[model samples]
Target: VVKERNLLEIIQKQFNLTDILINRRLKKRDINQCCQRLLDERQHFLNILTKCRLKIDKNYNLAQNGTISIPWDWSFASNETL
Candidate 1:
């Protein structure tokens, strides 16, 4: 195709240029690149996650047995024991 021919022509023209590194790296390592990519992705993820609120099953019984007092042992669970 014309695109392929143009790309090869450009490569031949810039073959002696030392200002750039076009060599593909190995699959194993890109520590700095990986860290920077992860940092960028994490920032975007956190920006979206902070504005989201998780929904739970509201129909489920959270306290069906009875009104249990605080700091008391019961069938459900006692956080005081923790």
Candidate 2:
């Protein structure tokens, strides 16, 4: 009976250890996925900002050459008070 009890105890300990290891691996995987998702979102936002900057630069250059009128350039107002 003593030998049987010892064997059972050893088996139970190994099972507990395996369970713990599996839990740790699952948590690590979840964290990695979350980090990757955040990185993807940040890259998408940066791409949008880059496109906006390029468009603004193009508009500014066109306005400087008088090829297009900027909406904020209100210098052509008459002296009529409203």
Best by the TM-score measure: 2
lDDT of 1 at 34: 30
Clashing pairs in 1: none
Q: What is the TM-score of each candidate against the true structure?
A: 0.20, 0.21
The alpha-carbon root-mean-square deviation between model 1 and the true structure, to one decimal in Å, is 25.5
Tell me the TM-score of model 1.
0.20
lDDT of each candidate versus the true structure? 0.27, 0.28
Model 2 C-alpha lDDT per residue in residues 1-79, reported as the tens digit of each score: 3543343233324323221111132334443443333234443334322222111111123324233211211122346
Cα lDDT over the full model 1: 0.27
Task: Write model 1 residue lDDT over 1-82, tens digit each, in one string.
Answer: 3543343233323332222111133221332333233234443334322322211111212234332111111122335322
Task: Count clashing pairs, candidate 1.
Answer: 0
Please name the candidate that would achieve the greatest lDDT relative to the true structure. 2
